[model samples]
Target: MRSVIIATENLGKFREIKTLLADEFDVFHSLRDFEEKVPVDEDSMLYIENAMKKARKVGDRFGMYAIADDSGLEVEALGGRPGVRSSRYGRSDDERIERLLSELEGVPWEKREAVFRAYLAFYLPEKQRCYVFYGELKGIIGFERKGVGGFGFDPVFYVPEWNRYLAEMTLEEKNVLSHRGRAIRAFKDFHNVRFFRNPTVHRL
Candidate 1:
């Protein structure tokens, strides 16, 4: 694709995706490149559905390849209370974390299993193809914040294998297993297999 746009206003998602695509594309662009933002809501229940919604909206707007992702944490104890509505849970990150912890109050760590999921939808308008990819990270919620890295609930999300919260790991470390990281990598693989076949299409 000559141009690309990420269907999100989130700084975190934008940064992560940009870093992931750095090697694949010499220079990548996102919705931020535009003077006005592309509008889309995460009202869909399924991640892929929401992703596609954003991707199509943005792809049509820019008339270029657009990628959108819908990701969130689903808590088992709460029966997936904050799945797609993760970003809408509260006005601020602190408020959202507090609300989630309050709802998970008195719950044991084992009962607080959660999964961080990401669904990526890439739309190639020229080819009229829409591709979707998914990735997930399994972990539990801790009693309190533990690390100084990551965003959102990363502070409270514990990774048993790593023996720490996601916030504890550096960007490179977290990307090794992060849901968004996995999904972004998958996007690269897709490009290499399908889109990257056109190596003459240089990134701008």
Candidate 2:
């Protein structure tokens, strides 16, 4: 099987990506399988830049194909704040949730609209080419946190049309509407149509 390195330390993300690409490539997490701790400075102002930097860093180091994703929640009321800093929005996850909740306090539910944005970067060292895929999920923020399934802002992100928090939905349900899932699906389709034609190269 051909191997691909997924540049991320988040276990939930790793699991999702592994499941998404299982049939097509052998996926390995940098932190778990390789014990790599090199931090890719995400100082880039844009999501694409950050994702590409991580993917390129891993691909260059291992001389293998690499994939990286940078995602975050963008609250319309907050002027897209806590975007790139989604993970570290506050001291801890709880703190982050608190901060978000506080920010939305007194705001109307309709004005509390938000969207999750994901940018996926793929790097092919041998080909010296980089590709990017993006996805967005639109939903409104709930008055209180709900569910306990997903990590990050899942509990606080509510889809009124679905009448449930993101964390409350099953993986299958989330995969169809979540930003990360949509990005992965687009990436897979791109790979299948654009890069997977040649069987000479092994996939990982």
Candidate 3:
């Protein structure tokens, strides 16, 4: 049976990945599913570094293929701040949102442009090599939080084309427009082509 580990403990991200890749694998797991956890230090300055670090660490620890992703919210007004440190921006999601809003206080809508970026790294334990995929979404930072869906900065991410906050969209809708979703989908497509041609690469 083909199985792979998702190198993340975030439930929201896990669910999104699972929803997209469930049919592709025989077994799927997140970091929380493991009894003995592998501690990973995500202190990389780049998103690809962090993602590959997690995938390599977890894949090597368990002797299986692993996929990891790192995503961030970069505000133009803040000079792309909170880029790789989006998760550490605050003690919690609310605090991060508050801090972001506070920093942009009194800033007009035109200057509130922001972008969400995601990088996904896949580790092939047998080959000891990692491949990365990238995706990004452009949007503006709303003055106030809107909607009740999505996790981390989604509420304040205003999609000018859609004219709705990310949080306002359903899972299906969000998946179609999210940065992580785009990256993961590209990763899936790459896997389909690679693994399909080299069937034994992952089955081993």
Candidate 4:
């Protein structure tokens, strides 16, 4: 049975990716699965670069395939102030939302345009090769946080098309409309083509 590591410590992110890739691999793992956890610094300016860094490190440590994702919220009004540092905006999710709202204080709703961007990186340790997939969801910042569904910025991310907050949507609904979901789907499609066509390639 083929096994792959998700290369993340975030429970919410691990759950979402694992749910989407449940049938893709025989065994799944996260950083918490091993005692000697691989340390990866997400210091890259680009999302893909940061994701690749994590995937490569974990894949090397575990001697298997590893998938990692780097995502952030980019606010147009703030000129993407927290694009790469979304996770570090504050100590907790609530604090992050508070900081974001505070930064956008007095900003009109129309100018509160923002987009959630995700980049998933798949790495093969033996081959030292990496593949990247990208996905994005555009929305505006809400006046206040709402719902208790998703983690991170979901509570305040207002989707005009859906006329609701991202946190208001169910898991299935968010999976179909989320940035990370789209990226993982794209990765799955690529894996199907590349691995199936070249069966021996995945054995590495």
Candidate 3 lowest-lDDT run of ten: 195-204
Native-referenced Cα lDDT, model 2: 0.82
Superposition error at 174 for model 2 (Å): 0.8
The list of candidate 3 runs beyond 4 A from truth reads 192-204
lDDT of 4: 0.87
Residue pairs with backbone atoms closer than 3 Å in model 3 (clashes): none
- For candidate 2, the C-alpha RMSD (Å) to the true structure equals 4.5
Q: What is the C-alpha lDDT of each candidate?
A: 0.81, 0.82, 0.87, 0.87
Tens digits of per-residue lDDT, candidate 3, 1-204, equal 989898988898998888878777889999999899799999888888888889989999999989998889999999999899999999988999999999999999999999999988888899888888888899999999999998999999999999999999998898887898888777777755544322111110
Report the C-alpha lDDT of model 1 over 116-199, residue by residue, as the tens digit. Answer: 998888888777667877788999999888878778999999999989899999888898889988887777766666453221
Ranking under lDDT, best-scoring first? 4, 3, 2, 1
How does model 1 fare in lDDT? Answer: 0.81
lDDT of 2 by residue, 17-119 (tens): 7777887785465556776566779997788888888888888888888989999999999999789888879877778989999998999987999999999
